[model samples]
Target: MKTIITSALVLGLSLSFSVSAVADDDAMMQAAGKELFNKCSACHSLDSSKNAFGPDLSGVVGRKAASLPRFAYSEALQKSDITWTEANLRKWIAGNDQFVPGTRMRHVEITDKAEQDYLIAYLKTL
Candidate 1:
């Protein structure tokens, strides 16, 4: 009985450590994502301080598409009923035209999975 209990405790500690280690990935992803968004800094502002060619994307992680005030969203974008999610952002960034037909964004697809993961992480923080 003592041997079994000790082994169980050890196993539990190992499992807990593994779970905690996995959570570190989320922070890493967020850091990586910020680096990816540097490319977007030219045309978009993630900070609320100002707007650029694109609407400010602050807090855009779960926001509805075209929901920002003052930006003139195209009819195509305004009517799409799209919501930004990690998966949807990936699609939109990869090919905006496919996601919203007739929209005007022209960014080239981000090809690195790590970068995309990081970008989504950064967007969530916005």
Candidate 2:
């Protein structure tokens, strides 16, 4: 009985540490993503209510493409059925042409998967 209780306690402590590590990793990733957004800040607004050249990205993680009421979206994006999941966002960032052909964002150059992951993480904060 004592051995079983000790093992359970060890397992619980290990799980706690694992969760904490994940939280730390997420925070670090978000920070890296924020730095990457400096390039995008020229066009995209992180504020939900503020639309810049691009629509505000607040709460975009699960949002439908071209759904922001205040901003004008390209016809292709407007017609798209995409829900902004992480995978879709990654593709959009790396190359919108491949993900959604005819997207107006034709010159975006980010292609590194790690960088995209960080940017997506930062975007999630908004």
| Candidate 2 lDDT tens digits, 35-57 | 99998888887666665788888
Model 1: lowest-lDDT 10 consecutive positions: 104-113
Clash statistics: count for each candidate: 3, 0
lDDT of 1: 0.83
- Model 1 residue pairs with clashes: 33-118, 33-119, 59-126
Per-residue lDDT of model 1, residues 70-125, tens digit only: 98888898998999987888988887888889886764588667788888878877
